[model samples]
Target: MDFYGIDTAPIVGVEPTDLPVIDVNDSRMDFVFLLEDDSYLHIEFQTTFKISDLERFKLYDAALYDQKKRRIYTYVVYGADINEAEEFLDHGSIQYRAHAIYMKGYDGDVIFDRLAKKIHNRETLTDEEQLQLIFLPLMHTKKEREELATDVVELAHQIEDENQRFRLIGATVGIGDKFLADSYIKKCWRC
Candidate 1:
């Protein structure tokens, strides 16, 4: 949320409800949370663009609304460049919309360089810095997934606190898996 400058209060995870929409077939959301104000925040990460993805977001939004009866804010974060900034689904009386965040808008090299400097100086990473580091791989496409994963893992290890290191590693592996190989990600974790 901070990455995109969206202000959010403290949030807690919300278990997904089984609201069966058509053709959903046990599909799960990427991440869902309950905000402090009792609204639902749903986020989906996509490596590539697909028209069906928008429909899935709509279904998730409808499900959340049906179960919680609260406002739902949904966003799709795309790892690849997208020409469109927003997606809208309108069917006569029904309308659904989601904001699109393009990862290419961020510069991974700048983020990595700042993090490396902080690590070199033995500075504790702020909460936002930690998050930026975890998401660094999505920002730039200069290197292959293996190379980027290796670099992120190396930076994650530089965290002085074991717990923070492990947490960052977990996030990196989880998100990096979309681009990196499982074996390579596992090796990075073991490191």
Candidate 2:
């Protein structure tokens, strides 16, 4: 939660559920967690702004509610390029809303440098730092988004823990799909 700067009750648990409730649907919800508060948290990563994005999420949340009959909190995490977002949609009696987190204020170059220094000194990366690495591509950067992403992938390769290294590298590649060129990611992903 802190990585995205979420301020809520201290989390005690996160259990994964079968979120793909619609078996034949092509649309997918990015991440959902059954939080400690007995409510569900539905999260989506958006690199661009579109009113339709909220519409799609509304449908997904409705489907999820139908399946689980639980309270759902939706949050849209916007990438660096998006400074503002539409947070609410009113459709007659039904109103849909999503909490927004903007990454425009964060500097990717500075985050990378700080994390790189830790790795250079052979320091174990905390879980927060690991998540920061996974999100490095989504932050503002001096270099092109693709370059910063690939560079983080290379830096992740140096992590001492094999499991941690592989997990974070794969996440970087997966998240990079939102903006980075497919060809560029394919070329640098080999590292």
Pick by TM-score: which candidate is best? Answer: 2
Candidate 1's C-alpha runs over 4 A off are: 12-26, 188-191
Q: Residue 181: error of model 2 in Å?
A: 3.6
Q: Would you give me the overall lDDT of model 2? A: 0.82
TM-score of each: 0.82, 0.85
Alpha-carbon RMSD, each predicted model: 2.9, 2.8
Clashing pairs in 1: none
List ranges where model 2 is wrong by over 4 Å: 9-26, 183-191
Candidate 1 least-lDDT 10 residues: 17-26
lDDT of each: 0.76, 0.82
Candidate 1 residue 151 Cα shift, in angstroms, is 1.8
Per-residue lDDT of model 2, residues 1-191, tens digit only: 77786765455555453457654344677777776766788878889989888888888888889987878888888889998999999999999999998888988899999999999899999989998898888888888887888899889889898899988887788778777788867775665
